[model samples]
Target: MPLSIYNTLNRRLEPLRPRDPKRVTFYTCGPTVYDDAHIGNFRSFLAADVLRRFIESPLCELEGSGPGPRSVVHVMNITDVGHMTDDDQADGGGEDKMAVAGRRLLEQKKSGKLPPGVELDPNSPYDIARFYTMRFLDDAKKLGLKVAIEHDKDASLMPRATANVPGMIALIGKLIERGHAYVVGPAGARVVYFHVPSFEGYGALSGNTLDALREGAGGRVGTENQSGKKHPADFLLWKEDSTHIMKWDSPWGAGYPGWHIECSVMSAARLCGSGSVLSPAQLVQMQVPDAQPIIDIHSGGEDNIFPHHECEIAQSCCAFNASHSGPYAGMWFHPRFLFVEGAKMSKSKGNFFTARQLYLPAPEGKGIAPAAIRLELIRTHYRSNANFTEQGLKDSARMVERWRRFMDTAGKGSTSSDAAARGACREAIAAAMHDDLNIAGVLGELNGWLGRVDAPGPEDAELLREIDAVLGVLELEQAKSAQTDIGVFIGCEADPAVLAKLNERVEAKKAKDFARSDAIRNDLAAMGYQIKDVAGGKVEVRRG
Candidate 1:
């Protein structure tokens, strides 16, 4: 069956057919880099990674052969600047996100979190941007999200927002010249804003009517205030103010570009190759093609559907209409938020934690493995709110261990993979992934298939390995470290509690009560012990 994905634009699952049949260009809205990225942020990243993997897999035909752009070009934008303290503000009244990071670094240094003699340049936005960007990339690596910067044309490219300010200025100028945007405020404090009424498709993405939006806007004015704008809903395109630490010289004044404008400029310049830096007049006179979205897929957290991404669509569509012409993204994909411990992960609730924090050991709390963390992220559907539970983490760890052992045993020799098992597993996995990334369904089917394979044929082993390629977990080296060293044979004395559980499981197995046997094994696994069955009716319970 053809791959189908839920397009947020149309509010339905549409067949994922690229306009350019040879390659797919996808853009995912990345981190704001104001602080350490939490697990909630990584959920969106991991979901995009899964989508990329599936698109490149054999089940999909998006990939094309050539030295040209790979079958997929995934561009993830790092918002290192202009992301405000509040989104409703038209005059960039909120604190600059990079400066926020800078202040945070200064605080860390004062708190002695940084080693002695490493002084941070307080004036440099580069310090904060580079620092957190590296951390975010490191987190992505730990989660095994592929990066496109390492000489891979089809790999994902993470473009920094600050790096494309010139392009943003040019685009904002175009918005002004085309009447899609207007200047607000007076003199040096003038802020350029996108006129909401100019675009007929303004609220199509968020489904908010202009009248309702205007009504809501009365209570949502920014620090500069929207009194000068044509409408209250007109968002800032350029902030011509001196207060921003991360400021640049622009035609409007010496201020930074607004938060929403960066995405439009960067995507157009980087992905679409709109290389020239032209003023609004220059762009309007240039015979640019009819309006069209430069990307194939645009993704982000569900929270960005309004004002942020919605503004992106309006500005980009208007900008394209002026210069190029059309859609911002063929399909929009927004992954639902990831909740922590059954509550919204909030600092006030004391539940928010980063991906790196999960690598630490406890009463500070023992952390979950990165692979297990990734498994937990993908355990639920991308469109669903996933609760990060301790039980779920434990279950994921056990599943990881199970897959490791299965692959190691199945891949003992490179005789061919079991063709039948490989095809069955592949078909099931493809269908799950295609059905709007129904990863929960995929895991259930995979777990059942793996559990039934007692002595995996080469094909079964090969199939499991192939499955791991998309799932992006199952590291045998790490699993080996968790396996029991001396218990490869008959019943060995370990912890008495574990031994007793093993006895009970053995009884359950003999009595043909497989469900009870599996439950006991899962219980042992939750307690940090893996029950591995050895030869001659013996089992080995090892510390995981």
Candidate 2:
């Protein structure tokens, strides 16, 4: 069966056929580095990760389908600048809470009310952005996301460096050259706005009329207004004058590139070439050689459709000249928002859970593991809003424990009847995942299959491994020592002689010597070490 995805542009579930069968270039707008990311932000990223995993999964093809001649190139850009706080704020009334808090803290320090040890750095925005970016990466790692950490790390370390400024300006120059954008002076400020009037079929992606677009744009009556724009729907390409913390030298003077332009410049520079766009044939050629370059799918929250993605489409298409596409992407996927206790998780309500805050302990001192929280987020349909609660997180943790127990049971022994049951389980799992990444459905199928297992067969074992590859929650082997201190238990406390004996026993288990393994376990138990058999035939030794 052909793969199908819901494209935001067409507003329908369409067949996913890349312009280049060999290589598919995909791009996702990454998190802005100004603040700590919340779980809701990571949910969008997880949806993209799952989509990428599906595209790249070996099981995606039918049996007899020899290695398909295709590759997926994924690119997610980190926005370090030009992201205004009011983008998501309705009526532009929302303030940058981080900045507000920083100012308040500064005032307290100035009044000599702060304790002697307390200190507030002058470069609070820079410090805050760096702190949150690092925390975001750590959280992403815990959730098993394979993001480009090296690039992100470099950006975080050198916060002042701007690598793509010249290329970005050139892109804007091309847009201006092609009459897709124009510079307008409004309210004594010269701002570059995309000429929405120039693009006749503007709202085709959103299926909104011009009047609707205007109304939506005009509705945003914030510190920044649309009066300067040629059309109310027009978005800024460059903010010419701003006293914001992060600014760059651009053709529009010492200002910052607009938020929407970052994706365009970054995507074009990384996927297509600088000053050149790839044709469909060239894209195919690039992919055939296993060049995981750009992405075939772009995903985010549903709220990013207008202005954000619309501007991205306009800028990218005009820059690349639609040379290598059936569509800009094979698909545009988006997940729904995550609410806290039936309400939107917002800072105003004090219900917001930043990645850092979530990693911290709850009121009772018990906290959810980052991985467990991630699983709970993914347990719901990406297209549906996930209601987050303490009970919900506990439920997800319990579910993970159940899966771990099943894997452990399967590894120990299996009966013929159990083997057959496991085979059925594998089939059910594949079917569930095939249905538009229906994770909730898959979990339900897992519960039913695991309940019937008296013993599992080879098929069940293989299926469990495959399922782990997709879900990433039941990482049985890795989770064994992930939460505890292995070094402290094994080599830290014990004498050299005792540690040597323990190492020999571990080696025996590695060599599959059951007698030696059992003897070692007995010896460890006699000692202060507690040896427990975990999933995948591995033993976790902890100091008793």
Candidate 3:
């Protein structure tokens, strides 16, 4: 079956066929290195990782004769600069995540929770960027995501002082030459603005009406200088103001490229090769073929579809002109927001949990395993609002445990079992994922299959492993760790009452009354211990 993905550009599910079958170029908007990213942010990333793994995984039959497709290149960028501070704020609506973390650290110090002499380097954005970027990478790794930087191409080419600036400037020059971008004056300062209205199919991605587009444009005026714009909707390509961090000489002036511009430039350079940057004026020459490669999939949070993604499409399409076809990306994917309780996760609300906080040992409060947390976050569909809770984590841990037990019983010696099982599991997983990445449906199916596997044969074992590859939560060794000596001790110390309830559940299951067993499980869960019914009728429970 052809892979079907819900393309935001077309507003429907479409078959995924890469322009070049040999290669697939995908770009996801990565975390800006201003502060520690929240778990909510990682959900979008994890979803992308799953897609990447699914696409890249070699297909095999029961015989295991040949390998399937592998990704020629996969590029995910790290935004170390130009992200606004307003998204972190409720009203200001900018991304001031670093500021929020700084405040929390100060509060911890005042309460004597943080040790004395702890300092955040104030003088250097690069230092700050590197610090948080590493933290983000650590968090992503814990979630089982293989996020590789295109170090040899993009990162190696970047200037140390201003990593992405040089490439960004070169891209802006291409856009200006193509006449897709224009310079505008705002209070004696010049800012480069991309001509958004020129693209006839501007609203195709977001499905916004012209009136809605105008309303959104109205808000962009005060936030930045939009005075020289021909229309209110034009977005800045380069900012003239801003000192001390990173700046490159551009056609506009000595300035930094806009946040959205860098991705277009970098993606083209990496995928299509570093040809002379195409500009609006140069686009009129029919002789020069549109040599820049187009992207197959562009993904991010739904919030970006409007100004961020919309502007990217407009500028890229207009600049490439006849060389390019329609939209920059054939398909667009956006995951829904992850919320803590009912509200959006934020530091100011005291509800946000960083990836580090979720995985690393906490001083006092209970913490879930990194794998369990990842399962919980992805349990719901990518398009659905995932409400995070301790119970949810426990539930995920239980499900993971069940799968692990089945795999262990099936054994690992039969290579054919791995291949056959993986094939069937991939079919099931792909069906769920293709349905708008229906992760909830996928997980539900997994639980049902686990319940049915009494003594899993080689087929069942391989299937479980394949599914686990996509789910990223069910390794037999990790499941063994779920009941290790240290794990039990940690559970006992963290929540003894909950542990007692788990023992009661085990007793109920021993009595052979499933109703009582399930009730006991629920009761123990209320207190925060996730119970898994392993093979041989043994029960393993862990503190969530």
Candidate 4:
């Protein structure tokens, strides 16, 4: 049987079918790096990672996502700028998230909780974004996210939003040319709004019609924001914000792109390929209509279904489709919300926990094992609301420890071939996993296998290892150090080689060679290092 998952758009189980059966294009809405990604964010990520791993696993070789060394082209974005402070803001009504992060980081530094040196500029939003981006990646490593493990190996797999503004600008321009978007207000302060009525079925994904949308109106916009919009339902493509720390040069003005726009562009750019959003004039020529959505699969948290994902459908179909052939992706996979201790998990409530806080040693709390954290985040069905609690973590820890001991006894060299038995067992788990990612069923099946008295002989142990690859719950003790990419972590001095690159960049800046300077800066940023210009021809470089 083919792999099937719950498609949120159609509210049904759909077979995993891609444009190219041999190669699948997958995209996930990754975290906005304003602060540490709390466990709720990771819950969604780990669930998606399960799907991704299954797509590339041997279970898929016969009838699923197709099997090869590079069959699934998975891309999870790194959102470092222009995220909304409120989810209702399709037009970026509140302050930019990066701007908020800069201030919040400084406050944390004052509170003596956050990690940043005294010399680090509290005003530099880039510094804060880089600092947290590295931390999030580190947390991901400890949890065994394969994409995070291979982040440095393939630059194309993880595209950063700040690094893709040019593509965003190009996509917005395409919208204007197609009559789906228009600019308003004065030249410098102009805001580009997607003309909602121009696109039919604007609210089909989220179940809000244009009339209802007008009543709800996405967000409570200020007089300034409300003044320029063509219709109440029309959302922002770009906004003019001179004070935003993360503004960029665009056709409309020097400002930030809206929260909704980033996912549409970033997803299309990577999954549909980079040429999908290159240059304004060439966009029409690059991607022709009738090909429908160039992406095969798109996944995110259930909260993203509103103005964010709905707006993505409008803008993406308008910009990338000549006719509305399909949604931006063939299938939409959304995991339900994660609750904490019977309440909605929120930082304001003091229940919010990062993966690090749960797994790494800290004074305020005892740490759980990294493997347990991974298991706790993903053991529940993706379609169900999974409540996070201390008891749940403890339960997860016990299970992980049991598996570790079982593997020690079972995971060893063997001569016997249990290929038929192993294949049958994997088929059972894969069937459950593919049935809307019924993860609980998979674990139940695993537990059943574990109960056998003579279980995990050499061949059975090999099969368990194969199953664990998809589960991603094994071998966390061997996780890479948090500072794998960075030569030196944040709050530490830069090494000699990084210093040399910094000096080279400074020299390039002195010579007014902006392209070279920008290239050097981006190269360093990709290596998890960020630079801040210091006084008198000097620079500060920190990595984490």
Q: Judging by lDDT against the true structure, name the best candidate.
A: 4
| Per-residue accuracy of model 2 over 294-330 as CA lDDT, tens digit each | 3357777888877577667667665554441224444
Off by over 4 Å in 4: 61-70, 82-93, 110-119, 214-225, 274-284, 412-423, 478-544
For model 1 the TM-score comes to 0.80
Q: Give, for candidate 2, the lowest lDDT window spanning 10 residues.
A: 284-293
TM-score of 3: 0.75
Weakest lDDT window of 10 consecutive positions for candidate 1? 476-485
State the displacement of the C-alpha of residue 56, model 4, in Å, after optimal TM-score superposition: 0.9
Given candidate 2, what's the lDDT at residue 399?
79
lDDT of 2 at 95: 53
Off by over 4 Å in 3: 58-67, 82-120, 148-162, 186-188, 209-212, 215-225, 242-245, 274-293, 321-325, 412-430, 475-544
lDDT of 3 at 503: 64
When 1 and 2 are scored with TM-score, the better candidate is 1
Q: How many residue pairs in model 1 have overlapping backbones?
A: 17
My TM-score estimates for the predictions, one after another, are: 0.80, 0.73, 0.75, 0.81
**Tens digit of per-residue lDDT, candidate 3, span 184-224:** 76533568777766567677677664557557654443434
Tens digits of per-residue lDDT, candidate 1, 1-544, equal: 6678899988999877676656677888888876778999989988988888777766653323322233666778888873443244434545555666677788877788864666567568877777777777777877777652331343226777777777788888777878888886788888888888888887778876586665675545443544677776777778776776778899889987877887876665556643233343443343335544557899899989987888898888887764423667888999999999999999899888888777433322244567888899987899989999888888998889788788777778556544676578778877887788888888878887777667765777767666776778864123212223323211123556766777788789999999999999899889876667767656655444
Candidate 1, lDDT over the whole model? 0.72
Please give the lDDT score at residue 525 for candidate 1: 81
